[model samples]
Target chain A: MKKVTAHDVARLAEVSQSAVSRAFTPGASVAPDTRERIEKAARKLGYRPNAIARSLITRRSRIIGLVMSYLENQFYPVVIERLCQALQRDGYHVLLFISQTEDADEVLTDILQYQVDGIVMASTTLSSALASDCQNAGIPVVLFNRVAQLGAMGAYSTSSVTSQNREGGRMVGELLLRTGHRRIAWLAGAEKTSTSRDREAGLCDALAAAGLALHARGVGNYDFAEARRAVHLLFRDPASRPDALFAANDHMAIAALETLRTELGLRVPHDVSVVGFDNVPQAAWPSFDLTTVQQNIDEMVDATRNLLFDQLGGQVMARSIDVPCVLMERGTVARRDDEPGRKPGRARQPA
Target chain B: MKKVTAHDVARLAEVSQSAVSRAFTPGASVAPDTRERIEKAARKLGYRPNAIARSLITRRSRIIGLVMSYLENQFYPVVIERLCQALQRDGYHVLLFISQTEDADEVLTDILQYQVDGIVMASTTLSSALASDCQNAGIPVVLFNRVAQLGAMGAYSTSSVTSQNREGGRMVGELLLRTGHRRIAWLAGAEKTSTSRDREAGLCDALAAAGLALHARGVGNYDFAEARRAVHLLFRDPASRPDALFAANDHMAIAALETLRTELGLRVPHDVSVVGFDNVPQAAWPSFDLTTVQQNIDEMVDATRNLLFDQLGGQVMARSIDVPCVLMERGTVARRDDEPGRKPGRARQPA
Candidate 1:
């Protein structure tokens, strides 16, 4: 026979579930007759409210606390949304904790009273001690986007899709060389992330193959304003301005285009060709028409969803998945033969 | 003196709060010395444990189950994001339970275990029985977006802010009548949502004021393909063809524009005028410089955030807030002198 839960007992007794809960709860009040009838119905139905019954035997809350930060980022939203949906699909109701300003200790304290099943930290820079605290209570934590110092615990690590960062950088380097560009400028995302480090290594590999090195480089912290500032620095010494600009991501590329168009009043491709990764919706806008590398969001999302399920279901999983990237050429670059503009010496000179 | 919380002990012990929980919990093990030291400190500090103690004395999970849905919509991500953040900030980690196109009873089983403190129905159409199930358990559910067939106990409702449809329709009606449009048509979203209803009603009011009625009308769901099909139906019989078209929302407007431009070879405002609402970023693109009503998303987000906080912090709040809208006139609407290129007798036919 299937488990006859409290809900079934409530139905059989014609009393509310809370009435049954009160009947089972010591010192909790229920009308005398209703309590007798509930007790009678419970015996007849073989109702096993063991999870609640266990509350008296072992005071476990069974609620899992989840902390997700950075909802504004398109990537985080979709990921968190999926995580929430999947967790809900499982038996666990997530108690959500969000930190707006990296308030780690406060976030940890906020959920302490509720006593959750476990905590899943999404987009956090939480210290190792916090993770220790959650697990120290015999609660396992799974970190998403952020890493934990302890490797034994579960963590859904996100790496770039496609040929790892080193290979991706090499592809860009080879493409630049084939197009006969010698001097290049590179704009990188925040130096803190492992992603930036790997991609940088790959780019160096490609540039080294062509017997050339990056002429100008700057870190943009993976944001538009920072990219704009970095680009401005590149232009300060016009003598070494790169022929082509390779930004870490599309947002930075769009910023470069905006600065070039409105500020410097330069026509794209003719003045400075730009390339970016992650072809966000705006990259295809009639204005920018940027060349980009696609990072298979569908595959990435699928992998994440599946991994989360595997983890939830107690299935062991490998540490990471490297999705591949493919170059998408739009209107951003120009061919050498077509480059006859104002300055003769300035013609197709790699920065 | 204020009661000392778990955080204070966790800080003093240099252990996580869950450690404090595990220490106090019988059969919930911690190192014996660690448990003794914590017990000593807590007693010395005159700190009483919180809800879990009461919950242990009684038999309650102290968890609030949440039933959430909706993912495809962009705003949903942000909504859930903030909801999760706020709920977490309020000391509740959402036990994410999601069921996609499956029997809800199957999902409810997961929630049955640690009978929750309350239930918050963020998204989904919960029938009366389900609502009662929650209410009877003394679970207060605050519904978001979806209405309660059973008079809802607590609800945060939305009022249409994107253009008072009737006013906007009337504005278009007056402009069309003044510019001499004898035939005007309506393209509408699904009849289910209140948004569609208000806009349609508003349109009818405007057209009636000008002594004009819709020459033809078609219905479509809020999707590009569906709207495209609805617009196609409007052109099936050319005899009742409209001189102008008003789409319920911007996506539908863009669909109509694309069809009119690519398939019908019609010039905007000259051959047919078009208007829409919710000026999404795509509407501002040079290719589709559509006239639209702007829904103040920022203000709406602010209001929603505050409302959620009010509810979380034991404060009652207003049922709903209507943000407001603005009509942006662009290249799509025609003027008096501009009608020279249109049909001769059709000049200035009201609405």
Candidate 2:
């Protein structure tokens, strides 16, 4: 088959090659009648102006570099899919670069060579140095669901969407106080991440307010296997075991339940109350039925898409979006009739 | 920050701009000593040869357009991620186009202006007309995880490593005969897809060899919700339900288990033996403990990456591949005490 060229379309349309090119180019002026003719002829011949050639002169490839990690979890996939859709809607393409390594600087160097106009770091695994380096390269980057220690770029997080972690912690602590459960434990995610740190701070603040304290704490690395191990170690000696347990993420919470069910032979909410953050899909799977603090994923994605577009349109004001979170009570938490709040197990009853 | 140019690197290295470009270009002519000096200078300044400008003269862009769908499936993410890593390793960047609608021709037309060297259809959604149009524009495309009815271009499938439907059906029939199962039923994936068709054919052949037949068959649309609904219909009358249930994928199997457990109060492998395909991550989770057929994903990925690279190296061998599958036994299936042919899965368990 012969290659179809812009010249062929131009000849067929009875116009210069430049007119054929202009018909494809945005904001490039040409007579409407001639432009229509050129388009029709190009369609007939299947001729398209080479964007790579044009990119040489314009220096804009219209590719956005997306750096992400933690795909084994459900959260990142939702964000990546929505971001791809929103970017594609605006006549741009996404160049995905997934990494599991700690050093973001090495990743940054590779992205810079691609000459992407901007970047969106949707993974908490991203290094602060890489974020700063991208800004240093004059590329606008917006961090999603994370915070930066060094003030180099824009960031958007949903700290407000859920009950203030500290306040929620206090409520739980006070409830424990009322229930006469003296000892309690906290099973948290890794300490390296800001999300883990913030939640821990909130839990401690609430405990202090109630004149109580977390009897034990363990790290789960935000995975089921790790959380299971953490729980096993925390409850190895019956004397030190807490009457209640709280995990920073749902995977850990689910693991804690498995440990409680298999190892200690404890009935959930009857012998020991439990709570978890980031109520994921499996939380409602009947088997787990965990009570958790729900982070509205759909709303978070909507906000992120808007933030990316705002940056593109030069909305450079220092803005932070606070998303609200809700406490979802299920079979995992103990019932208290006297407590002035929504009851547990409300969502779990079979309709 | 001022952009680092090849000229800057050349001046620092005490060489011409052409010499600096040669240092970066493989097999390009430059004195050995001069090339070393230029490379060192480029690394220090972080200068890259202007690939954007280079594309204008070469009439080839180191970009490939990828039209993809099935983002919600775990299978697609793993495939897309691998494809991205493979392309990046080859020094080529992907211009990703998300094709969700039937009007995939618009996506092709939109990408034509980008002058991509080739294309890959990782989507099950794009129509034949759209695919042919892309070919007409002089871009060679290879369908990944999809087959072309017209055979206009290259394609690779699991035909090489796995048994065809006829062979697979015979195996199942033989197993059922040996195990003394009287009645069997199958729930399949989307009827339009070749994967489903092939598997279904194999199972039927096995049934014929045993002088038995499929008691029932239904379509589940390769979804968990739909599979549950289909299972509900299949087992509405408990007395007449088939003793053995074979779900084509693990997602469907999990859904079936949930439906049977909660809705019908049926016990796994006791009242009804359930089998599934694709040993996904969740298959190992304690709640399901699914006994499933496994396709070696890593080996498939390795083969795919090599095939794509060979194509990039201009060795377009329009070949097909088929990876073999293994039947894994766990809590989902009844113990086959009589069978001596089954491979020991106790050794294959992931550590």
Candidate 3:
């Protein structure tokens, strides 16, 4: 098959090659009638302006490198979809990289080869060295849903957007306490993640304020299998089993709910109550109906885009924005006024 | 900040500019010690070879355009992660486009401008005209998890890798029948999707072979809320309620299970049996122990990668490959020999 070129479209439309190029170029000055004729001819010939050539001349690729991990968690996929849609609306394409390993230096190096205009590290941490490398290369980096521990010295033009995980945890703690729960156990996600640590800290702080201590603790590593195992170990001793459980994230919380009900043959809210963080889509289902903290994904995505665009437009300031989370009261927790033998209240409709 | 160029690296490293270029170029002849020296100086000076300039010279971007939709469905995230890993292993990057609308023509046009080497349309249909345009442009396109109804004339240069939806549906039918289920209902995905239609057709074919017909039908639109509504409608009349339910995908199947057990107050496998396609990770959870048909995602991904690479290597033939699905027997279906009051068998260990 013969390759369609600008010259072919120009000849067919009876216009110069430059005119055909101008018609394809966005924001380029072109007479409306001539542009229409050129577009018609281009359509007939299936001609497309080579972006590689145009990028070389403009020195901009209009592409962003999105580095993410943990697609299995469900929440990450929602965030990724929203981020991609937001970026596309702004005329930027995403070059996606799924990091399978903890050290993203190698993946970051490979992404640099593509000359992406900026980097969005969604749910993944960026090392200070790499942050500095990006700073020196004039590439902006925005950390989404994760924060860098790089102190002021290493804060090299890296911005971050995160949910108020600690505050969300505190809300969950207060809800569980107000519902008349005493034996409250906590399930943690990956211990290394800032999200897990901050949430755990907030829950602890809230419990301490209420003159109550966490009855038990286990690590789920943000995985279903690990969470199931954690549930079994936490509930092994019948005499001391928890009256309520709070998980660091929804995936683990769902796993705990299933394990407690199916394997342990325990009734939710009557025998034990459960609360989780990150009110994912599954939390609203009839089976789980888990009360959780809702992370405002849209706001986080908007902040991330604004930060990247601001950096691209020559505003180089590193800042962190924390969006508040809302507590979604659902079916898992027992109502304070309910009799001991009565059924739990129906799940509240999402507001 | 000033941009660092090859000349700067050469001057800093005390090497020829050609030697510096060769050091950065893969497979180019450069002494190992001299290469190390050049790399060190380049790192210090922040000098990296620009991909846009190199692509202009070589006429290859080593990038693949991955067009996808429906990330909300859990199955798709697994597939995306696997496909991205496979492509990255072969030294290619993914430029991801999430199609928010039915017509992908605009997205495809934008992707083409980036000069991607090929495209993998995962679970998205390509218009024949766009397929022809890609062919004329010498860009290979592979339809992953979907089949093209493009008549022989429109086949142009498109290949596809898909699961045997019909055979899988037949397997579901046989399993339900063998388990003594008489009245089986099916909840389908979006009507226009090939995955939905093919699975439904195969299911009907199997039931017809058994001298029976599908007892009930509902459209879930491949969504949880829709599936929950479908479940309620199907069970509204207890006298004629379905004895078995089959959902075209796992997400809807899960919704049906939750609705039946929690809202409808029906026991699974005793009052009704359930089966779903796509053995997503959640199927193995103890609470949902769902019986499903497992699409061999790894093999499908491998086939998709090979197909795309072959097309990029100048192979012009368009072929359709149907990978088989396996029936994963779990806790959702009753054993044929069990007494009417006995509990369903425990879920089988994943092989």
Number of the predicted model whose TM-score against the real structure is largest: 3
lDDT tens digits by residue: candidate 2, B1-351: 457899999899999988887887889888889988988998787675666667667766777777776465555566666667777777776777777752356677777777777677664534566655654554566666545544345332211122233444445555554555556788888777666667777777776655567777777877878988999898877666766787777767877888888888998877777777767766777778887777666666566556555555553544466666676777876645543443323212232
Model 1 error, position A302 (Å) = 5.9
Best candidate, DockQ: 3
**Where does candidate 3 stray beyond 4 Å?**
A1-3, A11-16, A151-157, A335-351, B14-16, B32-34, B152-157, B335-351
Query: Per-residue CA lDDT of candidate 1, range A1-351, in tens?
Result: 144667889999999888988897789888899999999999786454755455434545555666666554444545555666655555445666667754366777656665554566655645555554543444445555433334344343222123255566667666765665656788897675555666667777777665567778988877767888988888677666677788877767887887776667667777777888767655664457788776655565455555544543443432455667778788877554344432323323243
What value of lDDT does candidate 2 attain over all alpha carbons? 0.67
Candidate 3 docking class:
medium
lDDT (tens digit, per residue) of candidate 3 on A23-138: 98889999999999999999887787888888778767899999988799889889889999999999999999999864477799888877888999977876788888888777
RMSD of each: 8.9, 7.1, 5.7
Positional deviation of residue A277's Cα in model 1 after best superposition, in angstroms: 3.3
Query: lDDT per residue, candidate 3, B26-137, as tens digits?
Result: 8999999999999999988878787877887887899999998879889989988998999999989899999975447789989998889999888687788888888877
Write model 2 residue lDDT over A9-114, tens digit each, in one string. 9999999988888888789999999999998998887676766666666777777877766565555666677777777888777777766553355566667776
Worst 10 residues of 2 chain A by lDDT: A154-163
**Predicted structure with the largest lDDT when compared to the true one:** 3
Better of 1 and 2 by TM-score: 2
